[model samples]
Target: MSHYPVHTMATAPEASQPSLHALQSAFGFIPNIAGAMATSPVLSSSLVGLFGNVHGGSFTEPQIQVLLLTNAVTNEAEWAVAFHTTLALQQGLTPADVDAIRSARLPNDPAFAALSRLARTLIEKRGRLDVTDSAAFLQAGFTEEDLLEVIAVTAASTITNYTANVTKPPLEPAFRDHAWHPA
Candidate 1:
């Protein structure tokens, strides 16, 4: 069992309530990871703000999901893996592509393949991307701006991925069908 409480809006600390409510409004429910993060008002609120910026940035929702799912897999965060798996499919990523990401392979679509590879490389290399690392993404048709946005997406997922790893929150029902384990 998780030591961290999966706080609801009512049960969360005062500073965390707004962040919880924002998350609830965005997702139509507060994710268990977010609930756990609420235990730290700073974390919960920081995530809420960064979440907005990341989602509102240049990438499409499906593209964002691709990066998030990749990061979750690389981080080996079970809750985030399941959560992003569900979101990835809902955002129209094919099962084959999602499976590829979950299996630590690139997707069939070149753009998504670029995203997955970049995210995995970023995590594996700890943000130390050499020229060849960056050239591959640029070769895939993504701009320098998209590369930076990928970093933003990675940053957001890191918060959730690390939080989920630490909190060990229960997977929600909606995401349960996509449950994952590190290979």
Candidate 2:
């Protein structure tokens, strides 16, 4: 069993409540993972801040979801896989594309394929991308700026992915249909 407490707004430390509130406002409820993360004020706050920046950054919401889902799959974080899978579909990613990401394959769309490949490569290689690795992304029509933004999105998902692995938060019902297991 996980030692971490899945905090709620009322149960979280005072410093963490605001972050939880922000999550609530954004998602209509605080995710169980974020609730567990609330045990640490710093982590919860940092996640919320970085989340805003990443979601508001260069990529569209669907693109961001692609990176997040890819990262979760690569990291083998089950909770994150389910969470991101739900968000990716809600953001209008095709069912085939979502299935492709879950299966460790690229999507059909060129830009999404580039994003999934780059995210998986980033995690699998632990951020060590060579010229060829980056050239492929650029060749797929993403700019250098967009490439860096992928790092930012990856960073954001890494926080959640790692946290979910450690905290082992129970998946909420809303994401139940999309639940994933690492193969």
Candidate 3:
């Protein structure tokens, strides 16, 4: 296979020194995806900001992981699925929680599980959330705002997953142990 190009801030016009250095400082090395995104600093920065907002949203880390893993699974984006699964684990999601979300089953929390199902459905169906699904989400104790946040999380992951696939960014060493394998 042809190797994907390694993007450097020096070579990618859209990158600035501070942004590049910030990434280097955070990760101890700039991620390949961040490097490729150097081709469009605006895109990279916006994505970072958006995801930060989503991460800061009311949903717990494992809840976010359920949505991400569901999307990645539906999209057949193995890399994203693996990476986010690892993220869930790192954030203290139980093995059962991981398996539940990965299998598209809701754990004991029917409402959240329903929310997970709804996220996967919206992704698979391209934004056509059913009325009952909306009701289910509401019943699950998520507000309209949380639903919007769910969409945001899904959209954010879609962007990164596609970027990583297209750029073939090298998986960070920390993530390599969890490198993708198709389910």
How far does residue 54 in candidate 2 sit from its true spot (Å)?
Answer: 0.5
Report the number of clashing residue pairs per model. 0, 0, 0
Ten residues in sequence with the least summed lDDT for candidate 2: 150-159
When sorted by TM-score, best at the front, the candidate numbers are 1, 2, 3
Every candidate's lDDT: 0.94, 0.94, 0.72
Candidate 2's residue-wise lDDT over 93-117, tens digit each? 9999999999999999899999999
TM-score for each of the candidates: 0.99, 0.98, 0.81
What tens-digit string does per-residue lDDT give for candidate 1 at 3-24? 9999998899999999999999
Runs of candidate 1 with Cα error greater than 4 angstroms are: none
Point out the higher-scoring one by lDDT: 2 or 3: 2
Q: What is the C-alpha RMSD of each candidate to the true structure, in Å?
A: 0.6, 0.7, 2.8
lDDT of 2: 0.94
Q: Model 3: which ten-residue window has the lowest total lDDT?
A: 1-10
What are the clashing pairs of model 2?
none
lDDT of 3: 0.72
